[model samples]
Target: MSTFGDIFGAMRQVILTQARLDQLDVRMTRMAGDIDGLADGISLLRDRISRLEGIIEGAAMAASRQQRRIEE
Candidate 1:
């Protein structure tokens, strides 16, 4: 035979569990969004760096050609 007080305590515990679960869900959502933003930023930086590398390599190749001509 459960008393009224015991029933009230059980309900309070169930409510607390639900509240904590909701908080976790919100935190996970924010974290997922932040991770996506970071990934996008990283991809943009990679593209810029690849372009810069190509430019630097072209300049180096042109300089080498000039040096070879001078040597000849």
Candidate 2:
């Protein structure tokens, strides 16, 4: 009878452990998706910043050209 009880207890523990693992898997999957979305957002931000930098460089060049003409 004692052996039977031990076996049943072990089975119960295993079931609980399996359930926890499954829950963890679901959470990990969701976290991965969230990370992917964040990466995409960061990429978009980087692209916009690059575009802005280009625009600023162009403006600076124009200003310099204008200044040189004025000096002439």
Candidate 3:
């Protein structure tokens, strides 16, 4: 029932839609990889911050003890 022009137009639309979907798929995959990398970086930073916090706490405790010894 469709005319030739109509059929051709419909096929063209489908092709364009498929191309767009493929491009989007590639972009989404790259974005997912980037997000994973960012997550790893954040985790590393958190661990380093935790270690630094421990060092700071230990130093503060030691200074307090030294001050107490001097006062005594």
Candidate 4:
């Protein structure tokens, strides 16, 4: 036979567990948003890097042409 005190204690434990779970859910949601922001930042960096690579390649080609003309 379960005593009333035991039943109330169990109920209290259940409530506390649920509260903790809710807190975790909120934290997870915030973390997901942060991750999304990071992903956007990474994408922007990649685009800038690609543009810089193109500029560097153009400069290299121009230098090569100038060198060939000088050697002629």
Candidate-wise lDDT, in order: 0.99, 1.00, 0.99, 0.99
TM-score of 1: 0.86
- Candidate 4 segments exceeding 4 Å error: none
lDDT of 1 at 31: 100
The lDDT leader among the candidates is: 2
Across 35-69, the per-residue lDDT of candidate 1 in tens digits comes to: 99999999999999999999999999999999999
Clashing pairs in 3: none
Error of 1 at 18 (Å): 0.7
Clash count for candidate 2 is 0
What TM-score would every model get versus the actual structure?
0.86, 0.92, 0.92, 0.91
Deviation of model 1 at 8, angstroms: 2.2
- Residue 19, candidate 2: how far off, in angstroms? 0.4
Candidate 3 residue runs with Cα over 4 Å from true position: none
TM-score of 2: 0.92
Clashes of 1: 0
Model 1 regions lying over 4 Å from their true place: none
Cα RMSD (Å) per model? 1.8, 1.0, 1.7, 1.6
lDDT of 1 at 20: 100
